[model samples]
Target: MSSENQELRKVGLKVTLPRVKILNLLDQSDERHMSAEDVYKALLEAGEEVGLATVYRVLTQFEQAGLVERHNFDGGHSVFELDSGEHHDHMVCTETGQVFEFHNDEIESLQKKVADELGFELTGHNLVLYGKPKVN
Candidate 1:
């Protein structure tokens, strides 16, 4: 079995052609985040015969396997991204629907301080900032 197939087996997912295609597409994405529709379009553009439903199914499996993360942000449909094993937050552009990831030490320190004062130990958090660009 190929390494990719082995990974699917390890995650308790049955290895299939459509699943492999979706996994490869997710692996090759520039931003590593895509909606099901976007992934379907990508597969069509690449001449892969995978359907939209297959893309969604494969993404769901990948999410369950800890190979990907799904987020529903700002009333938009859910987005899927490969798990990169790093901690960060997202900033969304309201005007253009773009996303940027960033991290700051000062913000992290402040969060810890606030949690400490509240008598709670912080285990995890998600912070997303949304705004439109300033008109010049």
Candidate 2:
């Protein structure tokens, strides 16, 4: 049994061809984040017979199974990335639409401090910064 099959079974998802293909694509792709259209394009390039609708459906299933995380960025765009169980924030380049992942302990500490000062314990948070690369 392949690891992808095992992963799906572990997540209580029945292993199907489309699910396996999508899972493998998400796992092996260098671009950690991908939209459904991006995924469909890749599958087509790879000569997979899957359809765009199936890609959307499988991605939603993955998200529900906790196999991936969905981020709805500004401009109403959404992307999916495998849930690696590590916490990190994001930065979106306004011009290129590139998503960058970052981790900063200082920022994390500050957020916790602010939450505590507000009489609320921090349970979770998602911080996304948008920017344009410096021309210089």
Candidate 3:
């Protein structure tokens, strides 16, 4: 069986064409973050017979299956990325709308400390920093 099929089976999801295509697209995409519209466009460009609604549905299913992560970076649209198991934060460029991933032990520790001080367990958290690039 192909890896994609195995992944679908592992998640208890039936290996449908849409699910496998969407999963492969996300996994092979050079851009880590992609919105539903972006995925739809790519599918159309590749001559795949997929609807935008189907793309959205597949993405939502992937998110529920823990195969992908969704982020509402701009508070307007949500982008999806494959969940690679490693934890990382995001930095968004306001001017260009580009997203970058970063990992920092200090920041992680600080978050844990803050949560401990507040007497709340840090089950999960998302940190997104927005900024514009400086022009020299």
What does candidate 2's lDDT look like per residue over 2-107, in tens digits? 9999999999999999999999999999999999999999999999989999999999999999999999998786799999999999999999989999999999
Model 3 CA deviation exceeding 4 Å by range: none
Alpha-carbon runs more than 4 Å astray in model 2: none
Instruction: For candidate 3, give the lDDT.
Output: 0.95
lDDT of 3 by residue, 1-115 (tens): 9899999999999999999998889889999999999999998988999999999999999999999999999858999999999999999999888999999999999999999
lDDT of each: 0.85, 0.96, 0.95
Top candidate on lDDT is 2
Candidate 2 deviation (Cα RMSD): 0.8
RMSD of each: 1.7, 0.8, 0.9
| Over 4 Å off, model 1 | 1-3
Each candidate's TM vs. the true structure?
A: 0.89, 0.97, 0.97
* Candidate 2 accuracy as TM-score: 0.97
lDDT of 3 at 19: 90
